[model samples]
Target: MSLSVEEVRRRVAADWNGIVDVLDEKIALRSVSAEGIAGENMERSARFVADTLRKVGVDARVEQATGADGKPGAWEVIGEKIVDPDAPTVLLYAHHDVQPVPDPAEWNTDPFVGTVVGDRLFGRGSCDDGAGIAIHYGALEALGDDLGVNVKVFIEGEEEMGSPSFIPFIEAHRGEFKADVIVVADSGNWAPDIPSLTTSLRGNATCDVHVRVLGHAVHSGQYGGPILDANTVAAMLISSMYDREGNLAVPGLEGCEPIGGLERDVDELGLRADTGVVDSYELAGTGSLASRLWTKPSMTVIGFDATPVKDSFNVIAPECTFRLSVRVSPVQAPHAALEAIQVFCEEHAPFGAEVKVTMLEEGMGWAMDPDCAATKDAETAMAEAFGTAPVNMGQGGSIPFIPELQRIFPDAEVLVTGPEDPQSNAHSPNESVSVSGLEKDVVAEALLLDKLAHKPEPTNL
Candidate 1:
């Protein structure tokens, strides 16, 4: 017997506690894959993901692939359950790893513990992608054996580490992954209550710039007057990336045009709590709020190396470095944007302070064809699941693996959907997901899968 959408929703509601318990367990894994850390619990998390999928009726297994650096990457939980040979297959994708907690003391609650307070479930990966695993599980469990389409699951374990081995792994096993539709449960909605289909994603480009101003260290008290310190020169270079108005001044960088009927009347004041901006701090940049976040290039000096105030020294440093992270427009190439930044940095060098740049990470962005038949179906499913009209939105974040998936499977229609909200604060301390929104996400995915199963033949569907 085919399970109805109403039945799926009811099952999601009935099994909400189980879903939370699974999420909490996943959170407790400490599956952090960041910096050079290989994530101690990555294999365990992958096994747990595979077991969860197996229990839910999917034939799943844990797999791993060697990255370009010849090092083994994180474990991948892969499986498939084909209902019909001729039916279109839908690929369900999520990651099983979480980000490292740089400092647990900054969090209001334990970063590895899924603490539920009111409607929010707080944890490091609760909203980012751990909840994503639960969403897929809930949908499959609720649907039972009545899916109209085949399902393939790929739970990545190194997504938090920029998916270093994603390309090689997918290419090595390319034959195992061919789908008519791909659902990426890694992006969030417009708001907690507003359901959104992520239509575009900004790519990322990063580089570290080093500035040298002195040949040797000197006493600041003795040589501070005539010559500027290395830290001061590095600050000047950083300042060149933006204008006095606070907009990024890097030339040749790209910005996407605003979408029609999609420009939001942003309530900056209303979002103060979400942003946690300090009092009297004004927002920067130009253009619509949505455009600024989703389309245009945004740059920040994420890390700086200089002197430590506590380890104070009267010495003038000879060199300093700052790492710049850029989110390029979805349509712009990450390499191209990075090249522009390199040129801008060289040309805008202050006091001819021997500036040098070293490229770090670069990733291509992705955009979906919102007019596709699968997208149309997804909209209806989300609308029904949430009882409100859904919106097509763009995420400012970068999902490097997505564009690669599109490139490999040119025929598949990819959908970026998830349970995160603006307040989720993914990748930061006290990260969380809205409990109610997450429940709706389960229902939405189930409904979307059911709709795809019953759709017409795979003709750009």
Candidate 2:
């Protein structure tokens, strides 16, 4: 029997309570990366998801993928069944991995323990993505007896580490997981009550700058002034990458143009808050927030490791290194950006210090065609479910698998939306998801599946 919207809502509401129970159980297992609860915990979470999918009658399997470091630490749990092999398939994606919970004392409750306070469920990964995964499972369960479309769900375990194994896995299993549409539910809405469809993700490239000035550490009393401090040289070169106006000074980096339909005030405030800087600190660059965030190129000094500050006697350090993370425009090539940053740093080194810049990792950005029919259908479904229009947005953070998926499914439509709201506090202490948001997401996913399943074939671009 086909379920009405109200019936679906009711069914989801009933199922969500049980889903939360499962989420609590999952959270209690502590799936933190590279810690005490790393691989085993993630595997258990995957098994739980696989078992849940099986209970809903989907043929589920766990596929292990090697990490970038050639470690066998990552895996993807896929649950799929092609009811009609001739029908177009939709691929649903989410990650099962989570960031390590540092300092559980900072949390109101144990970081590994899911706590319900008022209308929200709080824990690590609860809103960052676990909520989305739970809702995906809930939606499928709601449609149990009346499954209408062929769907494949892929939950990865290394998204926290930039989805290192996703591309290789997708390439290796291309034919087995073919889909007409890919729905990524890892992003959040624009605001607490508003619905948003993420259409763009900024690319990420990381490079390290090492400045070696002295052959060895020398006493501050002996070589304080003339010895050429490696830390000072590194700091100067690293700081030079940004102009006095707070704009990136890296050469060959291209800027992006703002897309229409996004508001400036909202973007400005949101950017300030997101960067953890006060509104009084005027951000460099002119134009819309989207332009500055998505289209614009940004360079950041992520960290610096050298001599310890606690040491009593200062010395001319032999070497110092600063890690830089650059965000490129969706259209810019990562290798090109990496090279530009390296060349600029080397050329701009201070006082003839020996400088070395090395590319650590690179991932391309993605820009989805918003005018596509799948995007439109997703908008329609979201609007129907939330009783509001869905806004098109861009994420400054990079999801490494996004560009890969775009390349793999060149002709397919991709939509990124989820149950996360701005207040979810994902990847932070007190991470949580609203009960209302979870329910709305289930409704949105169910409606989206219904709409996409009935929609006409998309024309090739």
Candidate 3:
């Protein structure tokens, strides 16, 4: 039987306290997966997620993965509830990993020790994905045992570490995670009060660049005038990635123009990023700010290995390395974009310096088709839950697994929505989720599942 919206609402409210408790329990575990950080907490968190799902009438287990580096990777939780074989299936995705807490002092409250301040719940992973985990479980509880549709839940354990093992892990368990529609609860809405359906996302490619100008270090004071310095050469190459107006200078990359109704406040974004831009500090790139951020390709020098400012010597460095992160447009293929970046760097190196680029990680972007019937149903659900129509928005950030999921389930309609808002501050210190926002997500997802279940059987891919 199809559950009514009122039933979903009542179930969400009734399970509110229990949902909060689950979120708090997750935040309390410092499940970080960065280098030098422990993975024991990640494993524990994965187990916790699996156990929680088991209590909600789902069969769940934690599966260990093999990392991209060919070593042991983090653990992931996969759960399934099959209502009927012929019913449409919905795959819910979220991550259990949290970013490393760089400094405990930076957080107003203990990052792992969550605190409720009025409408907000503050903690690491509180909004980023912890809220998502709760939303899926809460929605299932609302639907009861006979959901009218099959549901599959995937809670990844190393998303914050860039999801290096995502493809391999999903490939290994392809049949178990198959579904007709995928809902990725990992992105944010446009604002705290406003909900949005993420329609597109940027792709990304990363590489390490090495510039060799000299065979060995030379005395800067004696040979600095004529000989080239690897550090200087590397900086110049990096600088060439941007134009005088700070737009990406790489040629042959494509960009999609922003849809007519999408807009974001520059000041609000600056405040969220904590980057105080002066009035005259013109925004980078061309087209609308939304287009520039979400649709255009951009580059960032994420890391560099040169002489440290604290331990600098009066010598010319022999070689320098810079890690380049290229954000590709949703319409561009990651491999092509990565190759362009490599070719551009090698061709533009200054002073005939030897340049080489080693590709690190590359993933394609995703865009939802506008004519899908599932999208209309999703839009209606979001509108009903938020009391306003959801904007078809584009996210500047990339989710590596989203595109992979698209490839794995070619006919599935991928809907990206989450409890996060601009103020959630995900991945930053003091991350939090609105108590009301989470409740709304539970309502929307539960309604979406119910609505889709009543539709005609899904078409074959």
What is the C-alpha local distance difference test score of each model? 0.86, 0.78, 0.84
For residues 24-69, could you state the per-residue lDDT of candidate 3 as single tens digits? 9999987877742236777888999999888787899988888767
Per-model TM against the reference: 0.87, 0.88, 0.89
Q: Which should have the higher lDDT, number 1 or number 2? A: 1
lDDT ranking, high to low: 1, 3, 2
Error of 1 at 69 (Å): 4.0
Give the C-alpha miss distance for residue 158 in model 3, angstroms. Answer: 2.1
Best by TM-score: 3
Point out the worst 10-residue segment of candidate 2 by lDDT: 258-267
Q: lDDT winner between 2 and 3, please give it.
A: 3
RMSD of each: 3.5, 3.5, 3.4
- Candidate 1 similarity to native, TM-score: 0.87
